[model samples]
Target: MEYKNNGHIRVFLVGHAISPNRGSEPGNTWNWAWELSKYTNVDVFAYPQHRKEIEKFILEHPRNNLRFHWVTLDNFDPWHPEKGESGLRFHYILWLRKVYKIIKNLIDNMQEPIVVHQVSWSTVSTPPPILQGVPIVWGPVSGGQVAPASFRDFFGNAWPKEMVRSWRVSFYPLILGWGRRVSSLPLILAVNRETEALLRKAGAKRVEFFLDCGVPSGFGLPKPQEVARPPGPLRLLWAGRLDFIKALPLVLMALRRVRVPVELLVAGDGPLKLQWQSAVQRLGLSDKVRFLGRIPWDKMKEVFQEAHAFVFTSLRDGFGCVVLEAMSFGLPVITLDHQGVGTFLPADAAIKVPVRTPEETFQAISEGIERLALDEDLRLRMSREAWRFAQEERWDRRAERMLALYEEVLSHAHRRV
Candidate 1:
């Protein structure tokens, strides 16, 4: 397994959204970088806002193999996005330009060649440095997922903003001419089937469906149960940003149809918070559902342990890490049979229903909920399978897979030379 240069492979990783050790918050950029550093020397180019958090993590958990190069954006705070992501896209493009310049200079002076790894937002049409002659790896990119036509039709002619965003993805190949770049890429790691197809259509030489999401180490550590409380109703949990794409309204509709008495714990907040709460009252589900807005990341474990099942209603997601985390807590997931939710969960781990119409989606969800409520044995079996799947998806295993792909790309490049 010795590399061509006979030492640990050095990687110039370009990831703008990396926040090391921020588990409770979203984004898995830190986990991917940190885990890979165990197998390779990674010099990361990330935004400056993560500097304090990264510094704190480095101080507590030392790793000599990893180095952080903060790519600062002057006077502008893109991370906060308080202005509704108005200039976020432009800001990232400009930031990547700076990253390219830095890497281009470093690559010229380096003694040994290094691989350029673009972690997330692995668009085929990226900045120039990513397309250079050096062996390049782009992945876990999340662009091609589109919401079901049924979802869009039910919502209205206007189309939810998410659907509009998906439409924009179609222009990538035409505008960026990504196929030209894909023809030369050493490796392309797509997160979902839609992205895989898009990459292939873009003429990618080698494309692999690779998941870039995982929980932190010891994430599923079990705690003693407090089973002394008198059980009254079945508890269901749904946690994520309260956005249109999450399809929170559809979940509420499904809850209205459930035959058994059930209580739902909703964690997290977003722009649609007021609308969702109003919908609960409109549907007379005020008593059945409770909104615990923006629960702390550490406290999510307690919420998952209390629930018998996790119902995910996201119409389209690049990769749903929460679904996997719910599985780690031994909760059987009930989700639609599409996108990341369908891609990540095995048949045994979840009660996946088709997503064609609003009524159909909610009806299937209601039946799945009732099935879990009426059948204890079925729930137990599914929970066991979910936990098993989560164990198999640990971060270390994903890291090993990623490093192996890097080695393959580099060795192949060497052989060609």
Candidate 2:
């Protein structure tokens, strides 16, 4: 295990959307960088859009082995609408030829020795050119590699709602494309079992379990009510894009059914903001619902903490990082069972809603509310359970596991040498 000749192992983490504006992804990026830094020299190579944030983050948290390198994209990476993603799939791949060399040179030029590791999304098409002999890992929670379509007709069409759903329907195809792009590369750390299976199916030689999302023991947020919040007006907080996929209307309808005086604090702004606001006005729930646009990450804990429970009504998520965040604060989540993250969560952290257009969500929310209200003991139990789980999955714990893996991977590399 003498790495004396190997010199120092350096891991280059590439995350395109690591910026302040992108709260979700950067949270993941910072944790990945922080974790990898523990085991090896981690140079955080990210898109330049986040230079300021990355610089600020690194300064606040200086690490011995971990470094941050932000990659500026003169032009955004290719996506579907840019002349048919499927058509230029092979052409888009050619861009990766450069990716390989840039990384390879870093490996070759290392004073002692080095290793390159990828944590999340890298815009490059194939394995970095220099990684031919190196162990490269990409994606624990790859964006685009989704499960097989149940039926061609099943996916939401530009439903009348899509026009008004306050979501980026256009991004759907792009999200899909991003997956195929990442899956093409070799993955060293697969975020979850589902993603691991996909990476293997796509021909990755080796994969490891490394969750893309991490949670702190506490986000400086208040714990959810030990008992449901006294049963009067339900202050339902619906954070995230008010877009189509979130099925906001179903949330609206579910709230609408509740005779209880309920208020919905809809946070996070998106394209269909006005449309959703208008719909709420149309439904005459003006007093019942309020749209609180994007709250700062540091302050988000307040919104979830103040609320009785966290509702993740989204049709999908990589692993619902927010869900983990919410649970870390001791809030129970009510979400759909169909998606990867939903099923992935411990049953104790959530109330699973059967996926149905509006009826199931409606009944589920209503039932969840009533159950929480009627059984304070149950609410307290769930709250304690969620908090315990999140602490167990805290970033520090996750990072330790990652460091162990890097040691193993590096050990393997040294043996080969």
Candidate 3:
């Protein structure tokens, strides 16, 4: 895994998807790929053919210093006639082994210092421990946003698992075995403190901190001159999935008695779409809210521009990228301070509320929003400061930090020789 000094920092990033879908999961891969491609000669190694149009369009329009390598896997689709036709876990195993072998071959072929950044979760195989000697970065690899009940104490309520066969899944036999085993890999570059902590709990050593999400520009907010009386009370904005773990109802319950006007704009959609609509109707505060369904990328800025503050009340988040996007808009953030989302936010830029009872959630939102709404001066000040911080946190910064970490490690590996 050692390398010579003169070669390009050839990066091999593996992920489930790089297209950056609306969900948090896709953001994890896309953000990292787009950022990393900026600093190094990079190539993305992804799953079998996803969409033909995307594949063809991307192949023809590759970015500078970046390439795409699609590793076709015999994906297990029950409805497909070819499903189980492989007669073994051959495709899955071969996919993992062949990809690594390809990376090793690439190193040999190009004489480049290879960095295998493996996005580990429930499916993708953990890179061989020996690959760590080559400066590998591990994940924002959240297989599912909703944790099973066993992990509920740490991950909040049981997460949505419509595709994961429910909590009937045995942790030891499946996820924990693979994910923990992967975490135990030496010299893993982790995304956040919570992830690092989890890896440590899983016996991970030689790990370093990294921010997985990308915060794009335009810290949008209503103009001071245009906004009158700040809409009274605490005007709040909470965006993300409408799923159960999102704790949308909990956020609603918390803001129930607040004196300020609390607004929760449910942005993304999921299985719990109907339930959220029902809850909103029952709450009788529909006037204070709006559900801008599946917002287009170009219009997200307009939405962020309208809000005063971003509130995230998810039970567990793997580096809440949306909060970063919110901060980029210079909206002050108030979020749960346990597990994933809490880890990515810098304390000075946002409000971190402890994940205690639902009461605390209510208190934080009610009071926090009012404080911002009433004090125009405070909003202006925080907005300016928030954007300043967000500017420094552009995905390029994250990519550079990772590159520096990789170069440092690679240098040491070479010196030891």
lDDT leader = 1
Ranking by TM-score: 1, 3, 2
Candidate 2 lDDT over 324-379, as tens digits, reads: 77777777777767545554667876788776445656888778866665666777
The residue-by-residue lDDT of candidate 3 on 327-399, one tens digit each, is 7777777777765556556665667776666666677766766676667777766766666666666766767
Lowest summed lDDT over 10 consecutive residues: which window, candidate 3?
217-226
* Best of the two (1, 3) by lDDT: 1
Kindly give the stretch of ten consecutive residues in candidate 2 with the minimal lDDT sum: 145-154
Ranking by lDDT: 1, 3, 2
Q: TM-score: which candidate is best?
A: 1
Query: Mind giving the per-residue lDDT tens digits that candidate 1 earns over 1-417?
Result: 322334368888888877754652225678777877877788988887567878888899999989988887777545455556677777877887778788888888886768888774554446234456578888777667888776774344447675667777776666554567666777888778887787777677888877767756887735322233235677999999987778788778999899898999999999889988998999999999999999887888888878888998887787687888888888888998887677768888799999877888889989998988888778878888888878767787777777778888988988998
- Pairs that collide, model 1: none
Residue 169 lDDT in model 1? 73
Q: Give each model's whole-structure lDDT.
A: 0.77, 0.61, 0.61
